[model samples]
Target: SVTGNRVAHTANIDRIAARGATFHRHFTPNQICSPSRATMATGLYPRHHGLWRNGVALDGRLPNLWQALSLAGYATKGVGKLHFQPLLAPVERDMPESLAYWERPGCEDWHGPYFGFDAVDLVMGEANEATRAGHYAAWLKRNHPEVVDLYEPDANPDSRAQDLNEVWKSAVPPELHYTS
Candidate 1:
């Protein structure tokens, strides 16, 4: 369906056809985030990496790309989301429902020196409008008490609805726009 979509005909994607090869047949060993990312890290499929879902962490024994790169004398720096486990104490599995407004936990520990990255800018939570205002948990308490009181598992009245490109454009700072 994505191949048939008109948006795929746009200039940016069209350039892929003009000078690049597109893999029509590719597969991820796991459909979920952590498992998929682990597969990427180790160049092994999910069965071998053993990361199953959002919360399950990769065993530290498994060799990862960062470790290999570091061994090769590369200065690793990660700037965006990597979805790896946090370095702090294993995160508490449970928090108030209000806290559920935040991003899923785990992988906060996966950044920085632990992962052989010399520098990292990590956000352990959702990077949306509500999160930009402050902690989504605290924002819920002060601003949208009614939404919080509803306790509906997916009631995000304050979350900003944004298109993918718009969200991406807004994320880039003016200073960096010229780099494109």
Candidate 2:
């Protein structure tokens, strides 16, 4: 579906692809999001990257594309959902700063040579849940506080993976959505 029929909202895609190279056959190492993304970031299989599932944590020892980009002085930056880590985990009340959360409160300040990116504006969740927290939310909160409520919060923290099309439809307006 990357190409074929064009929608009114994505006419620019056709225009751009017409001006550029097009790929007819491309495939990912894995089918799922997190593992696939891990493979993409490292240019290695999920087994080699050691993050074979959604909730798995990627070890920092491995070389990722962003780290390489940063090392090359490219001013590495990610402007959208970078699901580099797990979303949900058991929270210990003792450790206030566990790495369980990706789009947490202070994560906007974490520009990195750490992951290979010098600056990032990430949003991982799908549809309505994309507004949970990230650079987009932080920017919305800082620049447009009055419209913050329009981007609906994730009501169910433990909501299992399923089609939530109805829920998403009843969620935020596109103009108010804060995902980068």
Point out where model 1 deviates above 4 Å. 1-19, 86-111, 125-180
User: Model 1: how far is 95 from its true place, Å?
Assistant: 15
Tens-digit lDDT track of model 2 for 121-144: 666565555545655656667877
| TM-score for each model | 0.52, 0.68
> Model 1: which residue pairs collide?
84-107, 85-107, 85-108, 85-109, 85-110, 86-107, 86-108, 86-109, 87-109
Name the weakest run of 10 consecutive residues (lDDT summed) in model 1: 171-180
Best by TM-score: 2
Q: Residue by residue across 11-108, what tens digits does model 1's lDDT show?
A: 45566566887778897688877678788888887777777766665776788898889889998876544555522323263221122323355423
* C-alpha local distance difference test of each model: 0.50, 0.61
TM-score, structure 2 vs. true: 0.68
lDDT of 1 at 58: 70
